[model samples]
Target: MDPQTVYEKLGGSSDSEFPTLHSEVARTEGETPYLRHPGVILIAKPDVDIEGLRPFLEGYGEELNFDAYLDDPTPLPPGSLLLKTAGQTCYASFGPKRTYNENAQRYFDNLSSSGHGSVFEHAVFSFFVYGVSRAITHEVVRHRAGTAFSQLSQRFVSGKVLRFVERPEYQDVPTLHKRFEQRIDFLAREYDEVAEELVELQLQGDPRLVAEARTDMRKRVQQSARSVLPNEAETTMVLSANVRAWRHMIEMRTDQHAEREIRDLYFRIFLCLRLLEPMLFGDYDIESFADGTYGATTDWRKI
Candidate 1:
């Protein structure tokens, strides 16, 4: 889906007086320029099919029974259920002595404490991450394992309405903020002018080209013109990662020493995950620092 649609899906407001790259307007100072903060929407998650798992549990052995868990009125969250099931399958631990509904949290707690993170790979979550700077996405894509990313391509997408992310450090200082805004406004104008020139240049070469060919030519020109865009340019991506990968990213990105922008981004991500599956992300202890940014720590570091 397009970035605008994803941003709106993330609960970002569509109405803004200033121009925005997407539907969300994180911050708007005046009528001319606006700034945006990174946004994340959990679009997809794991869903456990108890009936599908029923056959496997039945075939495992007669000594173990998962009837109670299967029939429990309240079930574990899908990710938690999938992880617990995977963990139990490894040891055939399905029995009345340890039940899912009553003991899922404890089971996951042991998994975290004991560093059994492989089962976490069984549960995956997908998010549409937007309103972030390209710099932040550069760092995000570094997490290559057990993760998938589909990011917006400056090559194919026009930069006609470029939006920028103002650094947290610059926001409080009036001079710095004004300078940053001026730079962004200048860059936006330059990008538009350059793109128009390139488009004209292409048309001059072959004005008779068909509609499809014109589209291709426009993409080519945009690709070249986008080089003028700064690292602070807002971008969008769809990131899908397993629970283990998410934990690893959260632990690393939300550290005190991490870059403030990305740290804030991941902390927001952590909040989303915590709300979705507390059993999965409850170990994190989040705190706000003096700079008004947040950091998170977990005793279960690598798990």
Candidate 2:
């Protein structure tokens, strides 16, 4: 087929790259949506914790004189300095010999391009993400290295407020969208019914339990009923990752072949990092799509 005909057939632009297609594909019920969606917040990042560093550095010497001179007129941010210092410590590469003005930028640029990603481990970031489906977190928790996660517990929280993620595919289909909403509401109502039945059973066993341990019994009942929760249930999580881990995640998850929800998520993360530490993440060439999505290639050939 002609390139234009092929592009039209694929349902995307001529410039866009498409995921590999196959026949008889194994499909999951809760695969991520394939559209631009937003639900990431950069809650915290490394700041100049000068006071915190003072005590540790005192062990080296009482009067340690060190200075940095860079060709870039703009002074480096504290986060950049922190990354450089952490990397330099590994080689005992302090002083003008190793971190000279002439070689300073070159050193960091080379470090990133040469795949010495360990240096980035020193810088960490935290985010608060909500309004995402459980399916998204399932994929996120798989990246266990140099990261930590704390997510909302379905067992403890009451499933009364049943808000769920709406996938992009159904945006234009009002009937389907309404059906999805109704299904969620129905499930939540059923969950409440089951919890009430459990509570009544408990009360029958111990007449005074409802009056004396109302909260405990309710929580127990909800925990049991939580098994029925659907994958579309919205959840929240606080995710923390070091710079190295973030880079790895972005490289792997923001590709054309990655699940759309995760790709959308890490793309937001990439933007956040770029805003906070431009020197470190600015080299990445992130592309903005007409559909309001963002993505990038792992090839750091520019650096």
Candidate 3:
């Protein structure tokens, strides 16, 4: 199946929790509005080998002089198997076999609820996100901890078919939307024009570049012209972050005050997290509006 469909299935069949915006918000100064569409996709998540971790968990418990509790009847949280492995070692009470039982759930619940979120850092997820604006990524990259990123290079790819993102608020405003398209087209055209000039200069100055394909030379030139690209230009990236980093991102980006385009992106991510690790994410309150919008508060209720 396609990645998009897979992500949708992971989120179950829920309706959009995206929040609706007032028309005026789209027209706010310094904001270029466009239609909002879901863009984030789950590319990869942690694959925990439970048995593989048992020995270490057991050993850690012995070293710490604590016995793990293993008395609950409830099943283990599927999505958090990796987290369970790491968290089980935190208290170091139960032996390896008992560390994965119901008692582990209580331990994780306490750790998460108590704000010792560092344990969650052991579980990581990687995502391939597309159709997001450069503006949105600027905010996302600011998250410096427990995360790694690999993004499409405008210098290499901008010379191909150029794409752009439209803000949701501007979808209803035909004039503004048209203007947005026109501006994007203009920049793309200018990029090509500038690239051609730079390529010619390179060929004249360096004989070695001529031995390489014209495509390579063009790519090098594109690096120079990409400076003209706008923040609204569409881009793709692979973002990998541990569970704790993801929680921080979801909380910060889903706030009411966040930019609408980015809020929508993070909400989709939040849904995927809920599907993957309910016990970890289910306690967070995600609010939805009549207009198909959603967001969450900074605080999480204990599960």
Candidate 4:
């Protein structure tokens, strides 16, 4: 009966694709260390009824205080949905819709509260995530159906630089914040210098010594590097969710307890979708979990 559990069940089960990190001719310093967005094209549309959008706000954004969210349901509209989580607050909204009429894309630019009239499954999305933990990835990869994920490997790419998602609680303790930042800076510089030096030192050293030194260097690198990087550091990944998945992600990530960065990302993505169809997404309601997964009941009518 739990919403998220219901949604996960829809996916049948789940799958995590282990991709090989091909050793290609590596690029230079800029953008190389960061997660590069592997783009995937997506397209779709859903029919919406603006007049029906009013009665639709009933259970939508169940967590927001109506006094602050809309005050009156007569002309109610959802510009954005905010989630309160461990990392940061997230926001979601719908934009106007565009329809194909007589071989032309008719643009409807309306930003308001309108029910997305039950046509989300028509759209879909794909994404790639790098340098992330199995933990966070597990949470995200759970969309089950209408969602696909390709992740970096520990055996291949090596999590020697295991990254983490930091919580906002650390910010409250000024000392922890400074220490974390300082560690991040120091390790990053150390990794760059060490990796570079090891490569250079090995080029001239005896082959056997080079191998030994490489192992030692990686250890030393991981030492300081690991300390600087904690759970909440920035992670790079390309995420795509169709209209349905988008709504699902927004409802979950925008809850009052999701991580900050992920919640922020979902909010932005939701806003983008809303821009595409104000009537459809605007009209739909949402239910959220404290842990951040949107409640998905088996009863589609309820959703």
List clashing residue pairs in candidate 2. Answer: none
Candidate 3 lDDT at 212 equals 71
TM-score of each: 0.85, 0.74, 0.74, 0.42
lDDT (C-alpha, whole model) for all candidates: 0.75, 0.64, 0.65, 0.39
**Candidate 2 C-alpha error for residue 82, in Å:** 0.9
Which candidate number has the best lDDT? 1
- lDDT by residue (40-127, candidate 4, tens digit) is 1222232323334344434455453222222323331121111101001122222112111211111111211132313344434443
- Deviation from native of the Cα of residue 98 in model 4, angstroms: 20
Q: Return the candidate ranking by TM-score, descending.
A: 1, 3, 2, 4
Better of 2 and 3 by TM-score: 3
Tens digits of per-residue lDDT for model 1, 48-123: 7866667766775666666544666667778888888788778766677665566678888988999989999998
Each candidate: RMSD: 6.5, 9.8, 7.6, 17.5
Off by over 4 Å in 1: 1-33, 59-66, 206-212
Candidate 1: clashing residue pairs, number: 0
For TM-score, candidate 1 versus 3, the one ahead is 1
- For TM-score, the strongest prediction is 1
The residue-by-residue lDDT of candidate 2 on 1-303, one tens digit each, is 122332233232233221111111111233222222445666677775434544454555534422222222445655677787678778755434666533546767788889887787888888777666788889999999899999988876885454566665554687977676666667766777887777788768755334456667666777788887787777778889987788788888777777776776777666666656666775667665655455765565322
lDDT of 2: 0.64
